[model samples]
Target: MTGTRDRLAAQLEQWANRAHAARIAAPRRRPMPAGFLRGVSYAMTNRVDSSYASPRSFETLRALAKRDVNSISIMPFAFSRTASDPEIGFIHRNPSGETDEGTVLAVVHARQVGMSAMLKPQIWLGGGAFVGEIAMDREEDWKEWFADYRRFIVHNAVVAEAGQAELFCVGTELSKTEIRDGQWRSVIAAVRLATGAPLLYASNWAAGAVRVPFWDALDAIGVDFYDPLSANPLASDAELVLGARRAYAPLARLASTHRKPVVFTEAGYPPVRGAWLTPHEEPMDRPLDPEHAGRAIAAVFAALEREPGWKGVYWWKVFSDGQPAAPGSRDHNILGRAAERVVASAYARIARAVAGAPAR
Candidate 1:
C-alpha cells in the first residue's frame, strides 16, 4: 500500500510540474461569476476519528442558518477501523445495533436539504469512500469495487434526489487507482440517471492532476486543499494565500480549459500550537486570535474573489469542539476560533453582490 501511495504521489508531482510550467509560459485567468463567492464547511457529521456519536448533526445546520449562512456539504461516506468493516455500519449501529444506518443518514440529509432549500442555500453531498479504494494492480478487484461503488452511488443519489440536492460529488480523494480505472465515467452516468443533479469529484491537493480524468464530464472541479506548508512559526496570511494560489494554479487552468467552475470542496487552516500535528504538518503553530483569524479568513475570501473562474471556497469545518487553536489536537475539527463569523461576513458579501446585480 505504501509503495502504491508513493508511486501515485510521484505521478501527481509530474503532472503538477508540467501544469505549472505551462502556466508560467502563458498564464491564463477566467472571470468569476457574481454571487459565486460562498462558504461551505462540514456541518452534519462528526470527525471521522471521533468515537462519540453525534446527536442530531442537523442541529449544526440550524445554527449555521441562524447566522444567515446557507451553503453546506454533507459527508455520507461509510467509515470503519479497517477495510473489512461495513461502510454503512457507523450510521446504523448504536451501542447494540439498534437502528439502521440508511434510515439515519437519510433523515439527516433530508433535513439538511429541506432546511437549505428554504434558505435558498446550495446543498452538496460528498459520496465519501463509498466507491472504495482504487487498487493499482488488481484489475479484477477494481471491477468488483466499481460494481459495489455503483450501488452506493445509486443509494446516495436516491437520497439526494428525494432531498432535491443542488450538487452531489461522485467521489473523493481516491487518487492511487483513478487513472487506471475507467469506471468513474460509469459512476457519473449512474449518478446522473439517479439524481440528475450537478456532479463533482473531490481530489486532494497531492492527487490533483493524476486522478479523475473525466474533468470535462462533470459540472465543476472539486479539490481538497491541504498541501504541505513549512513548519515555520509565523507564516503570514498573504504568504499562505499566495502559496495556495500557486499550488492551485494547475487546477485553475484545467477548469478554464473545460469551462467548468472550480470549488474548493474542503480547505482549512488548523489553529494548533505545534510544529507537526497529526500526519500533516501545520504551516504555523501560533494560536490564532479570534479577531485575527477572522481577518485572515476574510483576506482569503478577498483573494479568491479576485481570482478568475473560481466559483467559491468551502472551509474544512464549522463546529468542532468550538475551541480556539484546537484544530490539530486530539480533535481534527477544521473550524477553530471565531472563524464562522468571518465566514458569515464573506457569504453576506457574496449575497450582496448577487442581489445588486441585474438579473440574467
Candidate 2:
C-alpha cells in the first residue's frame, strides 16, 4: 500500500513540475483596477451527499460581506422540493436537522438569520436531463419535455418572486441542449415571464463558445472557470498568475465583443493535489493543503483584478455537513479550507479599496 501511494505521489509531482515549467513562458501580468472588486459565496445544494448549507454558511457570508460582498447566489434546484408537490415547502435539512418546505420559506429562514443583501439564486437545467440520447433521437418529442421543464423553472420563478432575488440563472452547463432549435430563447422567455429579476445562464468552460447563440437572449455572461491547472507542483504565485491570464484571455475578449459583464458562476482550487479534473469527472479526494489552496486562489484574484469587465466571482463552495459520499473521502467539502481563507482575504482587500468611495 505504501509503495502504491508513493508512486501516485511521484506521478503527481511530475505533472505539477511540467505545469510549472510551461507557466514560466507565459505572458506578462496586468494590474486590475483597485476599486472594481466584488465578492460572493456560492451556496451548495444536495447533489453531492456531503454538501449541505448551515446557519454558519450564512454567518460566513455575512462576515465575508463585511469585506464588501454586495451579493449572494443560492441554488434553488435540488435543495428545494419538486415542483409537482406544492405542499413540500422546503425539502432541505437545515443545520438544526429540520426540513422546510417551499423555496420562499428557506430564504426567509436565511434572512431571519441575517443573510441580507441582493440574493442571486440559480436554477440548473440543460444537462443530461434536458438533452440525453433518448431525447435527442425523438426531436419531435421536445415540446412536451420543454413544457415540463418550463413548469419546473416556473417553480423557481415563484421562489424568486417570494425572495426578491436580485439575479437568477435560467440554466447551468447545458451546452448540447442550448444549441437546439431556439430552445434557449423559449426558456428565457418563460423564466422572464415567471420572474422579473435579471437573468443569466451558466455554461461550463468547454461549452462557453458554442453557447454564444443563447447569450443574446440573456442579460449577462455566466461561466464556470474550473479548467484543470496543468503546471509544476512548485510553481510560484507569479507563474500561476501568468498562466491564468493566458487561459482566460479568450474570455476577456469575448466579454468585450459581447458587451456583457462576466460572472464567474463557480471557481475554486481544492486544497489537495490531483483534486482538479475536467467537468465530466467527479471531484477526487486529497488532503487539504491550506497553503497551496490559498496561493492558487490568490493567483486567480490577481488575474481577475488585472482583467476588465469581470462583474463578480463566486467560490465553488462555502460550507457542508453530512456523511461522506464514500468512506474516507475528503471530496465532501465544507468549512473554510486554505483556499477559502485566501479568497476571503482577497475580498477584504477589494472591499478596502472601494471603502468610502462612490458606487459605480
Candidate 3:
C-alpha cells in the first residue's frame, strides 16, 4: 500500500509540475457561469476505491448532473494519532481506499459529466476518536506533526492541481492545530508551491468555524455546516426553514466581516428519527426517517438561498456506486430517496433563477 501510494504521489507531483509550467505560458481560460454549486460529497473508502475508475462511478456522476448538481467534492482520507502523532500515521492512499490515482480519475470524470470538482483532503484520528478533540501538548510535537502534515497536503495539492480540480481544501476541521496561526500560515504557503487552485479550509461549524484565525490566508471560508435547526425531528418545514435562517445568519455576518464567500463544504442530516435534534452528531442506531432528512435538506437550501454571503453547499455524502438505501438503514446516503428529489428540485430552482449564482 505504501509503495503504491508513493508511486501515485510521484506521478501526481510530475503532473502538477507540467500543469503549472503550462499555466505560466497559456492564456487564461474563460470564466465559468455564475451558477451556485449544487454538490454532493462522495466518500471513497478502501472497499470502493477502485469504483472511481469504473463505469459505475461515471454513471453516478452523470446521474448527479441530471439532478442539476454543478459540483462534486471528492473527499480523500489520510490519518493521524491524537494531534501529537509525529508521523502522519498510516497515509491511507491504500489501493483498496482513496488512492491518488483514483481521486484524479474521479475529478476527471466529474468534469466530463459537466460538474466541477473540489478535492477535499481530510485527516482522521488513528483511534477513531472525534477529530475535533485532536491536539498536541508540546512544542516539539507540533513541529513534527506539521512536517508530516505538510507532506500529506502537498501530495493532495499536486493531485488537485494536476487533476485541474476547481477547489482544494488545505485541511479540514483541525480546530486545535488551526489555532497555531503561524504554523498554519506556513502550511498554506507550502501548498501554494504546488497548486494555483482556489484553496480553503473546512472548519467545523460553530465549534471551530467561527474561531479560525487563518480565514484571510484562504480563498474562501469553508464550513461543515451541521448546526441543528430544530429540536423536533418532525418539525414543520416552515419551522425548520426559519430555524435554519437564524442559525446561518451569524455565519453570514462572519463572512461579511472577512469579505470572503462562505462555502458549506459538508452538510447533511441522517435518515434517522430525531436527527434534527443533534444534526452534526453521527447518527445512532434508529428507525429510518427519510421524510425528516428530506425536510432538513430542503430547509437548508431554502435558508441559504436567501443568504448572499454563502457561496455553495455540498451535501454530506453519497457513494458513487449507487448503493440503494435499504428500508431501515439510517446512514447518510440519500440516493434513491425523497431527499434526492428535494436536492434536484432545489438545484433546478436556483439554476433557473440566477443562471450561475452561488447559493444566492
Candidate 4:
C-alpha cells in the first residue's frame, strides 16, 4: 500500500509540473460572459478543410436559430490508440473539422448566426471504447498520459480563446482519471491560463458528475446525461416524467451543494423503439420510432425545466453540413423527426423566458 501511494504521488507531481508550464505558454484574453445554452451538439461527420464554416454550414446554424435553439456545443475530437494508451493528440491526417482552424471557423460562424458556441474537445479511443473507461495501469503511463492531456487541453484552450467561444469544456467522461483530484485541478488551471472562456467538465451520467472533487473550480456542473428514464418501453409519459425526476433528484442535490448551475452537456434518445429503456445505446433489431424519442425529451423537460439549478440541455447531435438527417436513421438526430418538434417546443420556452435573448 505504501509503495502504491508513493508511485501515485510521484506520478501526480511530474504531471502537475508539465501542466503548469503549459498554462504559462497560453496567450491572455478576457472571457466573454456565459449564456442560456439552449442548443444541440454540432458536427456528426469528420468534415474536410473549410467545410464546417462554408455558406451551407452557416445556413445550418440559421436553421437551428429558427427552431429556437440559441447555442451549439461544437464537438471537436482527438484520438488515442486505446483507452489505456495515454498519448492523446491529433492525428496527422485528422479531419479538418477536428483541427484548430476548423474549430475556430465553426465558432465564428455560430456567432454570426446569433448563437453561442461551447468549444468541447472530446477524446475518441480506438475500438469505439467508452471514454469513461479510460485508465492507465502503470504509474509511468498515467504520468505520461496526464502530461500529454494537459498539452491537448491547453492547445485547444488557445483555439477556444481565439474564437471567443462562450464556454470551454476541459475534459469529458474520463472518470477513471477523476481519482487524481489534485492533478485534475492542475489541468484546469492550465486551461484557465490558456483561455478566459468559462470552463466546464463533462461528467458521465452515472457517477463522475456526483463525485468529481473539483466541481467548485468550474463555472457550471456538466453531465452527459443519458440516464434511462424508464425501463418499460410502454411506460406512459407521466411515469417517465416521474422517473426523470427521481433520477435527477440526487443531481439536484449535488447542484444545491455546489451552488452552481447544472447543464446537460449532452442528452438525446435515438429515434428507436424502447430507446427510453436504454437511452445510451441503439439496440439491434429495434424499429425506428421518432414518437418515442419525442416523448422521452418532453418528459425530461417536464421534469427539469423549472428546477432552480437547471440551466439547459445540449441535444446529443445534429449533422454539420446543414443537410437533414436521413428520415429512417437510427442515430440520435432530432432534425425533422418528432423529437425535433419537442425540442422546438422546449427551446421556444427557453428563448422566450430563460435566455430572454431576442432572435436574429
For model 1, what is the alpha-carbon lDDT of residue 41? 57
The 10-residue segment with the lowest total lDDT in model 3: 24-33
Pairing residues by index, what is the TM-score of model 2? 0.69
lDDT of each: 0.53, 0.55, 0.79, 0.82
**Better candidate number, 2 or 4, judged by TM-score:** 4
Best by lDDT: 4
TM-score of 3: 0.87
Question: Best candidate per TM-score, number?
Answer: 4
- Model 4, residue 292: distance off in Å is 0.3
Clashes of 2: 16
Clashing pairs in 1: 30-309, 92-101
TM-score of each: 0.67, 0.69, 0.87, 0.88
Candidate 1 structure quality by residue, lDDT tens digits, 1-360: 999999999999999999878732211211222345354555433343221124344444555555555555655544433333222222334432212342334334435543321001121224423223434345565566566667766666656666555567777666754674457887777677666556677786623653568887777787766553333445566664565566667877787688887777776655444321221333344563344344445556755666666776667665522333343443334344455667777777676676766321
lDDT of 3 by residue, 1-360 (tens): 999999999999999999888844321222322557788988764465336766778888888898898899987777776655666754445666777788899999999889889888887886777677777777897788888889888888888878888888898878777778999999998887778778889888744687898888888888898888888766888999898887787677778888888888998888877666777665666667777888888888877786777788898778878676767677777787777878889998877888654434
Backbone clashes for every candidate come to 2, 16, 6, 0
Number of the candidate with higher TM-score, 1 or 3:
3
- C-alpha lDDT (0 to 100) for residue 161 of candidate 2: 58
Model 3 ranges off by over 4 Å: 1-33, 48-50, 90-93, 356-360
Quote model 4's TM-score.
0.88
